[model samples]
Target: MSLHDTADDAEPRGPRGIQSIEVGGQLLLALAHHGRPLPLKDLAREAGMVPAKAHPYLVSFQKVGLVAQDAGSGHYGLGPLALQMGLIGLQQYDPLRLATPLIEELAEALGLTVALAMWGNRGPTIVRVAEAATPVHVTMRHGTVMSLRDTASGRLFAALLPPERLREALGAGLDELATDAPFQQALSEIRAGQPARAEGDAVPGIHALAVPVFDSLGRLVLGLTVVGPGAAIDLGPQGAVARRMQQAAQALSQQLGWRGSA
Candidate 1:
């Protein structure tokens, strides 16, 4: 089998210049997603490219150790080179390092669980968590995926997302937004209107308030959330928590080089 057969069918369309490079990159991405060895024919079909055209690029990628071939089956898979590069990039980011103290402080002040979450491919995933220092408290495990429509963190994330991206993330159309009035209102409220607290959206008994943190580019990178029993942090207390979370998020954003309008 060739490499094209096992790749994603979707292909990006564009004008002439840089098309080859784009296609090659897409092919590589498809291979990476599969995470399994594939023959050149399978890869070409998946990428919707001719085998003859893809052969040279595959050879080039192999030379740089970006892709490797199995000795027995001659099938291709991602090589260690890409993993090493990704690790190098990840090392430069220290969101958890910057967020841990903030989460601890929030948890202590609010007497609730606090978490730092970032958008991931699967959804918004918690990166750091601080459990309330109480006998019983709300708990959210680190690396857990949370819903984008319901959770406080998810709302904050959607608020930071570009309009088109947000729409894609939600998988909802504009018409649906009108029918789903509550979601539209929540999106507007969280994105630019104000900080938000959500109750009984994701799961019962849990209440959460989240604020957005932006990077130097004014891009939303993560969110800070305080979570507790619904009764403990009612609407009134939730507002207070939102205010504090906003301040913390702003401070962190400044630290990250965001200078956008407040």
Candidate 2:
């Protein structure tokens, strides 16, 4: 072939990667999937390779502190460097940053505004808002602290957050709220995996449905809210908007490492 033909053939459609490195990554992925030490044979089987083929990759991984072999059982597990990398990845996982694009997509798809709220020291606070193409008549804004008893987002936190955190957030108010029947009932409904719904209660002309997003520990990380004019969106717990929000929130939760059922 001519030099020009050789050059044309060598041009890549995308960034070229080391094939051996990709093969080695499959072993690492298998280890992560099992979440426990595996014998060489089992590890190789999981990686879709034979033990002999997987040994050299494992040795290289050990040298880099990515995998460790148990002295007693000779089984391999993730090593210190892998743990460090995982922690660093988790530290960089900002829920608000990750959810911005998702909420924007939700807003566009549903034709309703979407908001992300997280528990602040004071209470549930709106951290981000994605406005719909057609603006909804609502009073929500970034940094708005939602009413714990009056808003969908607030009630979602009240229901799904850990009891210790709820106590800290409520303090003395927890004792008084314990006896409130309506508040208890609302929380029970939310704990059953139903999205919190408020219709013209928190705001005169707005309706909202809020769902919870969780992390690897199954802890509530944030609340996703869909808001629109009362006449524009379905506000029922089982409505199209609520179902769509649940699906979206579940997907986001999975991205955040949540392995629990929705």
Candidate 3:
């Protein structure tokens, strides 16, 4: 028999390595693929491992906060450290490079200013902005850090990004845009608005709409937004700008290897 062929005809085979470590990894993989926290038995069953065997690994993961356990329901979830790690990777992930062309196309096609916002060390920062041909004096630009409680892009981040990072941004004195009752009300509106969010004249006379792009991992990768003169912009659910922005966002999300919106 050729070396390419397996000794046992009943099952196809490949090279084998350490079994115990592979089994442990299955538990983690199960948790990740499930897309939600799991109890001990469910986690083990998903991994094809016994509960008793999985407990030891779970204990180790919990100690480092890679896996956090809820005291009430005894569920396990990816912890703060995991979210922090993912966010760190995002800074160097070059999502803008992948997203810019699509962004430019949308801007030119719609005659609107488009921008991509991502979580930066300080807060939600506009990393790139594509302007329309007949330019308007839009307030936002590249490297402009948005105010979480004020701007539409900022509010999007405040609504979705990890709470720990939000707290850090607030601590850095980026709270100048106060979250007063009215501001809180706007945030509520954004969350309640299904599909996407819109804020009329978020920046003085400029109107904007934003839609979040979530990755397959069920995380907010970025926000894609369009800005234009308030008089011409429409924020209605069935408006032209809002629908096009959402379509572009859907395409971009797929390009980022996202198959489903979380």
Candidate 4:
């Protein structure tokens, strides 16, 4: 079943009278829509509950590992149990299996390195890679952890992350980095759904273009990226690459029964 179906199957029907359960359900929805961890106040606001009333439900969720509290930031995110549940639900769709051939086709067509990445606790991890046949290529080994602030794929993934969680992941005081005009511009572009590129950031002489992949409910689940030698594929060609990658991602999402707008 798709994520939506799984959620529907798990949802309680006929309206139970328990206030706690209702609050918990609302909290879950807020987290899903936010696509990132939220602090107590923000989560309460999103759920339409006051912090005092929401605390008990959050505490219960934490105890059950349905939610996690960040040690450094004290924010709450879907915990290991929630992730396991999502994975269990996603396994029915087999995203990686569905995405393989699409990545291969993208690599062949563009003659560039193509990759699919999924977000993890730390950052986006390269779950799959299809290298170009060309002798000279950008090398991103499978299982590479992308920097949330740097590479093209990383920027797109980070853009989908919750602002608070993103700040935490980027460490404190991003304003220092904001002083750099290029860094600010890159971030602005990513937020605007435009592709981003950087030289010698992720890999030397490598340039990359990336697009976000959304699931059935319009939640970002992964990123599709193509990278190659700077001369072979520059920012000028990114639009073409992005179009193809978006098509492939949409197809893969459809195979996974995603019904959301791509």
Best by TM-score: 2
Cα lDDT tens digits for candidate 2, 1-262 = 8999999999877888899999999999999988899999999999999999999999999999999999999999999999899878777888888899999999999999999999999899999999999887667888999988889998899888877897887898878878889988989999998889887788788888999999878989999999988887787778899899999999988777777777
lDDT per residue as tens, model 3, 1-262? 7654644665766898898777777877787677699999999999887899899988888787778999999998887877677567655545677788988998899998889999888787888888899776866778888766657787788776666778776774546444467766666665665334445535567777788887746577889988888876787857888788878777767655566742
Per-model TM values vs. the true structure? 0.58, 0.85, 0.58, 0.57
Judge candidate 4 at residue 168 and give its lDDT.
64
RMSD of each: 18.9, 3.0, 9.2, 13.5
| Model 2 regions more than 4 Å off | 1-12, 230-239
Model 4 clashing residue pairs (backbone) = none
Tens digit of lDDT per residue, candidate 4, span 1-262?
Answer: 8999999999878855986687688988898777799999999999998999888898999999988889999998898998898777766776677777888888899998888988765677899998888834444677888876678877776666666665665656455655767776777877776665656687788778887776666667778888888887757534676667767777777556466544
**Candidate lDDT values, in order:** 0.75, 0.90, 0.76, 0.76
User: Which pairs of residues clash in candidate 3, taking residues 3 or more apart in a chain or in different chains?
Assistant: none
